[model samples]
Target: MKKLVLWMVMAPVTGLCLSFMYSPSAVNHPSSKTGKLIISFRNSVDALPLELNKTYINSLQEPFKVTRLKYYISHIELDNTSAVITPDANYFLVNEEAPVSKTITVPFPAGSYHRITFLLGVDSLRNVSGAQSGALDPLNGMFWTWNSGYIMAKLEGRSPASSLPLQQFEFHIGGFQGRDNVLKKISLAFPGGKPFVLKAGKTLTIDINANIQKWFQGPRSISIATHPSCTTPGSLAKQIADNYAEMFSIVSVTD
Candidate 1:
């Protein structure tokens, strides 16, 4: 009877000690206070599903088919937390072909954030910095050879506008310098500038829809037939980049 009571009493103490040893409170306790941010990318036309290789006409009745659409969004930051989640954890290569690539996550310290900001393209620093892995990896096919920089966005498809042999168009836009600086830093505020609280162990989700219509109907309407690929940095690339400036919009946010 005495031994039974002793074993029971010591068992509780032993379990308590093991719990502390296995928990994160012993190491980087701050990580325990962090939550997750999920950003979703969708290809759509006026909120409808976008079909690849299917002919979709523009305002001018020009028929086009989007065989490929890929882009990069980097250097994301959220306001209201002392802890920082930098580009490496935030940059993403959004590809329409890869359904799993549509969502990107950022781990941040749990707190109330009033604003969120991110770059539309990979910054100049990262492009010339040298080879990287993960989303920025060259094997992903977003990087450009010879020019020694990333192709911020690539749009490949066919259009009746193309009188060429293949009736195809390609736009590989990427530049971080003056005149050709296509990188756009966009800041979005929560509804009514309200702050959204990130609770520990909870994830916050935001939907970002890339409107294809805006690509064909922005400040300057694009005609793939008249204007072909933008393989290099120049005015043509800039013009195409300008049109895509309105490509992204925050559709919804859910906790």
Candidate 2:
């Protein structure tokens, strides 16, 4: 009994000594290396890049034009074993028509990243916290005045499949509370099909596939004619958001 007790008491001390001897103060003395990450968004199908102002056939065989496609992305995190890279400017609003808004550059700690994760919309806290600026600003025309919340995504255009006035269809999706919350967390592993190693001062550009056809696929096929718009919180909004959850895919990654 005494021998066993003595071993147990000494085990912790031995571990502590070993840890101190083998482990350097790595956290305090982090590697002074950082890199720039470039992210791009595009709408494509069948691996073919999409052309705006052009009508395309969905899985439902309905013709539609994507005049505008904008969405919010926030809280980007690059997964790492030793450290995570999260830039100070994490919120972004991506607009398809605006060439400049389609991509963003962020600074990150130099390291090997295994996966990339990001949020599709503002969190519950930000929604309830009142007005904000930058990507989450109300002047962006993505806010819902009646309910008071930022619109996570917007899909507006004309469609021959619609019976609505002028054959117009507008989808403004946003809800950051309760069961109808539209916030989506997406995780991408080696978005370039391999591990990304960031050099000390290099930049890596990645093409993101923002497939719009996915909006018509999911538990059910979405009809542009009947369901012209989904601007409120309910089953339709949830369903539409679910369809858009898989909108992002990695097209190319260049270091």
Candidate 3:
């Protein structure tokens, strides 16, 4: 009777110990606050889905028709109170003119985090690092082989809304060296939650709004006169990319 009781008590505890030893939490020793993160997308200025507005043809002065829109984001970080949860670079990419859904696991020191800070696009390190997968996948069409980098932002459309015909614009904004670097880092805060609690094995879905009209919001409709594509280094791409960086905002989170 004594041996049986001891076995019952030790079996579960022993299994749990071994599980923790091999878990990802063991590498960083995450606290009880650890949880999974869910991210979603929205377009704020206009209800237009980000997917529909990502192409340059979509940016013409008038007669806007969207044939296609796509891009990629890599090396993301989620900022919290006690620690920053940065996932592997193999994570997300915005493609096929569709808003994407992804779950990223961030290991923190264990505590509630009310807000998060992240990148609107990939960091310079991965942009310069050679070939990659997912968002970095060369097959995704966001990368530029001749220039040796990624197209940080892409928009296309045509409308009875503009004056130009067959207008298309492509903005590939990134250059680690010199006047065209377009990586954007953003921080968002949440109120009313004290040390936000993340229970183990649970997932939180967060909604992010990428304002589609943000590119043309402050400025007049992009002149159809500007260069059609960023085949060479110049200001057209830089201006549009800078505009695209300002398009993101946080909408909500579901735990």
Candidate 4:
């Protein structure tokens, strides 16, 4: 059997100290009064939850089954009416097949935040930095090579629309330089523009839905019959990035 290795780096490992930053105009609260923020990623098709190996129809009306799906999320930020709060930079790999990898929890200062923003891919600095341990470890199979950098996001599955042997479609999106850069910054406002307060010593849960159907449409329409493979970064990769950049939306917030 072929080994299935999903791409993208993991989040901060256990025991890493997470620091919170407050804007200059914001009040500095005691570190002891911090709360916890739990961000959850829910992957789905147009109207159904995504399941591995289950056939689903895309915007192009193509039937496909995803065997693996993985992506990186980084540089998370939270914004309130008064100021913007940022957590220490961390790269997280959200894998569809791994439930534990889909949720991220970090300590955050208590505040009423109405907006959240984050990068859809690894930063340029981390791309060029020499091999590191933990999530960024090259052994994870997300890194392409020393020159090509990491694979920001990856999707692999079978589709009857594909022309390749075995009717397989693969998209490994990555690039950190010049015109090929696929890094995208995504910002989403809380539903109804209402802020959710996180009380000290308490936890606030934010559910985010990622619609896979958005990958096939948006700024561009991609058909597996025409373009089934995107192993390297270029214009097509950028288009796909733009499409998936709109895939994330806030679903619900609980405090």
Candidate 5:
């Protein structure tokens, strides 16, 4: 009787240990295990980098004052030689401030990815998908309550061409219908699959350059004098947002 009881107890314990060791969640494969990646937001205006530290604050150009800069990024897709890893509910918000930064844990199948593609702004589906938490939390201050959707992009600052009072430029770009709809897709290729590697406890870093010229590319230049605030989804907002989306480029990647 004593032997039988010991055996019964040991049986489940042994099985549990084996299950943990061989479980899919515990398995670490290049194509199975998930690796972490960090995404950072960099601010630039009129061809100069924006640093929140007081030292470089004075370096900003005359017409390019960096007041507020924010955007939404989600639906991460990683393309490797064998498969494409698309994680569900992957969303992130990028903002600028003192030591401003947002890090995302991009879980991939421990394999090397040759290229990556993502959306610059929230998709129309998730835009109107209603309340969410974490990166999608409305309380994070990224959503527009009056508009009933997310603010696709935000560029705020005071320029000489701007008007009085706030004397700033607020271009909030967002639209889910018609030609005014503006959601851009950005893709970057990693050759030789070098920067896409993942080792235990290692992290990959990618720096993307947001070119200021891209903001003026589509319809017309952002004349703060004429269009100062994007109270809603208007013409100037759409044009500037469209132009700015094209400026996204991968500057550097390190593992």
Candidate 6:
């Protein structure tokens, strides 16, 4: 009877141990329902790929060369047919000269998404949260003083149209308070309104084009010759922000 009781307990324990040892490891499983979403920014001027120091004409018919171009993208959200998924709250500095900085990757779950939305500038929360690290680091030159907040977008270059001494134009746009706010939220839908299907363990890349010309012409016409530099936040900055808010468009999506 003692041996029978011992065997009964040991049999189930042994079976449990064997089951755990033989079960497939979740980490090694091939059916993980997680994927990656890559967002790539392609800067362009008049439909041509942007190259630094290459002369291009703006909508105002002014010839200029971009010496530097940088902007912030944040608050990314993916919208599915049934739900909205915010992968994470992260800020990305897309530098026109930095190839690696142009691509942003986020871990996403398998889903059929139709729309992707993101902020073109850092949100007010992070702006008021004091100094930060990583992409929000002040050393990145995106942030102004803590009181002035961050530079939403910066464009610098030389143009004969510029009235500055060196024929240089600088647009350091920044503001987060009241009417000075230049934060822009941009939403893009897949081509043909088709659903973008992301499979498990696979990666999807979304190519976005930022037309530099849109900065000069959209709702308002900004003449480089007349207003070459806007370094502070005000009505001109807000107008520029409104113009650039329409700069991004979906170019393509690939697996």
Clashing pairs in 5: 30-111, 214-243
- Backbone clashes for every candidate come to 1, 0, 22, 0, 2, 0
Indicate the TM-score of model 2: 0.82
Candidate 2 on 82-133: residue-level lDDT in tens? Answer: 2233332457898887789988777777877767778888777778778787
Tens-digit lDDT track of model 3 for 119-204: 65666777688867655677877677887777665665554443345555444555544676666666666545543555566665
TM-score: the better of candidates 5 and 6 = 6
Q: Put down candidate 5 lDDT per residue, 196-233, tens digits, no spaces.
A: 67554566666776665455444456555666777577
Model 4: runs farther than 4 Å from truth?
1-30, 80-89
lDDT of predicted model 2: 0.79
Instruction: Give the range of the ten consecutive residues with the poorest summed lDDT in model 5.
Output: 53-62
TM-scores of all predicted structures? 0.82, 0.82, 0.68, 0.83, 0.73, 0.84
Identify the leading candidate in terms of lDDT: 6
lDDT of each: 0.79, 0.79, 0.57, 0.82, 0.64, 0.86
* Candidate 6 Cα errors over 4 Å, as ranges: 1-32, 80-89
Worst 10 residues of 4 by lDDT: 1-10
Candidate 4: tens digits of C-alpha lDDT, residues 1-255: 123222112223222323223224333443766787789999999779999999999989999999999998887777722112332236788989889989987667788888888888889888887866556777767899745598888888999999999999998889989999999988888888788898888888889999988888879998999999998989998899889888998889898
Candidate 4 lDDT score relative to the true structure: 0.82
Question: Candidate 3: misplaced stretches above 4 Å?
Answer: 1-33, 50-63, 80-91, 96-110, 159-165, 191-195, 218-221, 225-228, 231-233
Q: Which candidate do you rate higher for lDDT, 2 or 4?
A: 4
Quote the positional error of residue 101 for candidate 6 in Å.
0.3
